[model samples]
Target: MPDEMALLVAEVFEAAGVLRRSGEAIAAADGQTQARWQLLSVVSEEPLTVARAARRLGIARQGVQRVANDLVREDLAVFRPNPDHRGSPLLALTPHGRRVLDKITRRATEVHRTLAADIPVDEIIRARALLHRLVERVNRHEGDGRIPPG
Candidate 1:
C-alpha cells in the first residue's frame, strides 16, 4: 500500500510539473507568467484581499501580496478599499486585466480543445473526481503530522 501511494505521489508531482510548464507557456502569449495569470484569474471572479487570494490559491500570503503589487504596478489590476477589512484592500481586475484574461481564456480554450480531442470525456471526469478525492483526503489529514498509510 505504501509503495502504491509512493508511486501515486511521484506521478502526481510529475504531472503537476508538466502542467505548470505548459500553463506557463500558455500564459506567456498574453505577456504574463503562470503566477500572475493565476492571481489575475482569481481576482477576476471577485475582488479579494491578498490573504484571501493566497488561501484560495493554496500559496503563501506574502507571495500573493507581491504579485498583487506587481499587477497593480502594471495597471493590470487595482486595489480597492475593502469594507470588511480596513487594512487589507480588495484586489480587482482593471479593464486591461480583463482584456488580457479574456485573451488568455480564449487561448486556453483552444489548447484544451486540442488536448481533449483524443481524450475521452468520461476518463477526464473520472480523473477530476479522483483528484478531488485525493485533495479531500489530504486536507482531512492536514497538520496531523502523519498520513495514514493507504
Candidate 2:
C-alpha cells in the first residue's frame, strides 16, 4: 500500500495538474491566454501596483512589468498614478478587460459543470476543506522555518 504521505503528495500533484490542464483547455477554446487572464483577474478585483501583483502571482517584478506594458499597449489595462508609492503605478482593468473576463468566466463555468458532473457535491466540499487545512498547515510550518513533510 502507498504511504499516507506519498498518497497525499500524489493527490496534490494530480490536483495541480488537473487545474492547470483545465485552465489551458478553456483558454485554448477561445484563443485566450494565461498571462492575459491572470493580469485581468488581478486587476478585476482592485487596482494593484505591478510589484504587488507580481508578488501575489509569484512572478518576477520585471515579468509583471513587461506584461503590464503589453496590457497597456493593448488597451486592456491602464496604469494610474499610485498615491501609495512614489513612482510605481496601479494597474486597472479597462472595459475590454472586463468583457474578456466575463466571457472567460462563463466558459470556465461550463467547463467546470461538464468536468465536475461525475464528482459528488459533498466530496467537493470535503476536498475543499481538506485543501484549505493543508495550505494553512504548510504555511504555518514554513513561517516557523520548518520544512512541511508531504
The best candidate in terms of TM-score: 1
Model 1, range 1-150, lDDT digits (tens) per residue?
Answer: 379878888999998999889889999998899999999999998999999999999999999999999999999999999999899999999999999989988988898899899999999999999989999878778647477733
TM-score of each: 0.92, 0.86
Top lDDT hit: 1
Candidate 2: which stretches are off by over 4 Å? 148-150
Model 2 vs truth, CA RMSD: 2.5
Judged by whole-model lDDT over C-alpha atoms, candidate 1 comes out at 0.92
Runs off by more than 4 Å, candidate 1: 143-150
lDDT of candidate 2 over 75-146, digit per residue (tens): 889999998886989999999878877888789989899988999999999989988899788878978879
- lDDT (CA) for every model shown? 0.92, 0.84
In model 2, the clashing pairs are none
**After aligning candidate 2 to the native by TM-score, how far in Å is the CA of 112 from where it should be?**
0.4
Q: State the number of backbone clashes in model 1.
A: 0
